[model samples]
Target: MYTEENTARLLPDVAVHAQPHLVGELDWVGMDGIEVPVRFDAGDGDVQRASARVGAFVNLRRPDKRGIHMSRLYLQVEQALSTQTLSTATLRDLLRGFLDSHKDLSDRACLSIRFEHLVRRPALRSANSGWRSYPVTIEASMIGEELLLEFGTEIVYSSTCPASAALSRQLIQDQFAKDFDAGKAVEHAAVLAWLGSEKGIVATPHAQRSVARLRVRPAEGAAFNLIDLIDVTEQALGTPVQTAVKREDEQAFALANGGNLMFCEDAARRIQKALDADKALSDFHIRVEHQESLHPHDAVAYASKGVEGGYAGKGCA
Candidate 1:
């Protein structure tokens, strides 16, 4: 089927290939948040004390005609390691540079960093306390001239379910009363024996592990303190976890748990209202996951941080 002209064209070698007339649309997908460990705050303290790690997400843009440069993202982050100064402001600057590096395709960018911000505290009784870290994090995004910033912390609180414990007490009381009302009043020895048996044991209520996740978008020139959210969340949970716990502190923790028995659902609702009432956050995604011991499955519930979606008070919460 070959002609003289076609054979001549097919055999010739060329230095250039034809350029594309059009390009395809690309989805610049990414892993939004990843926990990374690196040395942070290394200039002022001992190596052990100075050791710090923070989670971060890099901004990326996919090419319409070809592919995205993934290795470049990793290179930028690895460079931050030796520099050692990473703050909210520094992160903002870094992201802008990232976006500008790939301006031909994508128009939006996002980044999130999670890390433990530590503080040293003295022991309650002994002078033997060390350092404890709090979960501190930041999230940011840029689309054209518009910018979004968010920050938060996650804290643990123990709350005991009072209703469940009260029922246990009532059941024990009824059993004692019925025994006393019988033809023969129960003897002290017999009562003592009953108390030693499983039949007379009172079931203590279970405590719940609660988490508070908050996101905020502050006005221009406004200061959004992440610690403020930490304080509010710990308070909302009733009892915050202690960094240094002696016998007395342990007892106090137990007492707090005995008083606040909340299911995973209770924790979510309480936190949702707290954020809703606050003027700081208006649109957020709030999720609480409860790891259960009684069952193999975990209980979870979610609420949007600052939206007007009707809360139906359904399912677990």
Candidate 2:
């Protein structure tokens, strides 16, 4: 049955109301990419609310344009915020409500929570301390008889290239050895001055602020602790942020950084190696983003458990 008059007609001061027209249950429903500030730790009265962009994507399929109610998704997220400590467990409830929200209209649902995780950091070379933010994303889906949980985390650090350092070191040794062969004892300060100056340098390996991110599915369901995963991620990446750093800490950090000099490809390989060794990670995807200081663009490397397109190390290329 098709009627053009019914589609176009709108009442002029007429009291008439009808529910939305539905062909069938939806494949997915609910809102997505909605931004909200989430507060956890129900015990504390003065707990700070962490900012999280929270929303669900439920499975809905409707032949007609008008399908699931849009307001339901907003309400579910609001409900989550008003009551509940937002852990992996709570996200499942929000998804179940998402499906139940539509009743028979939806059979499956998906949800994603995106947030900027903040932690205090002390300056690398100074006493100043401030908060640094890392992008974090968590997503879950209800499909058929199984529920899937996925977690994503990112950490920022710096990388320095070691290959370039080795070549420069060799050049100085050769130059001094030749001078010594001619019965001339070259002053050590002269070698230092030449190498320290830009003239004697061919190309110094540059390090930049880097971001390491990982994605994984939890096998233990909602009870899984994402904090441990976060720690593992930071440890795998090598240069983690420091909260409280005195001069000694700063010196230690500098020593650590110099020792852990890595290229973008090296960082990726290092993470891949770590992932291969870790028992907790069954399936994972890791990406390293190096924000180059020498160049305006970033250098990146990606890796997976199966080693598909993942630059394991600089030797990989």
Each model's lDDT comes to 0.58, 0.67
lDDT per residue (tens digit) for residues 186-208 in model 1: 68898899888776855656555
Model 1: weakest 10-residue lDDT segment is 42-51
For residues 178-223, write the lDDT of model 2, one tens digit per residue: 5455576667898778767665654455667788877765546334
On a 0 to 1 TM-score scale, where does candidate 2 land against the true structure? 0.71
Question: What TM-score would every model get versus the actual structure?
Answer: 0.66, 0.71
Error of 2 at 19 (Å): 14
Please list all clashing residue pairs in model 1, or write none if there are none.
159-260, 160-260, 160-261, 161-261, 282-306, 284-305
What lDDT is reached at residue 50 by model 2? 71
- Quick one: best TM-score, which candidate? 2
- Supply candidate 2's per-residue lDDT for 171: 72
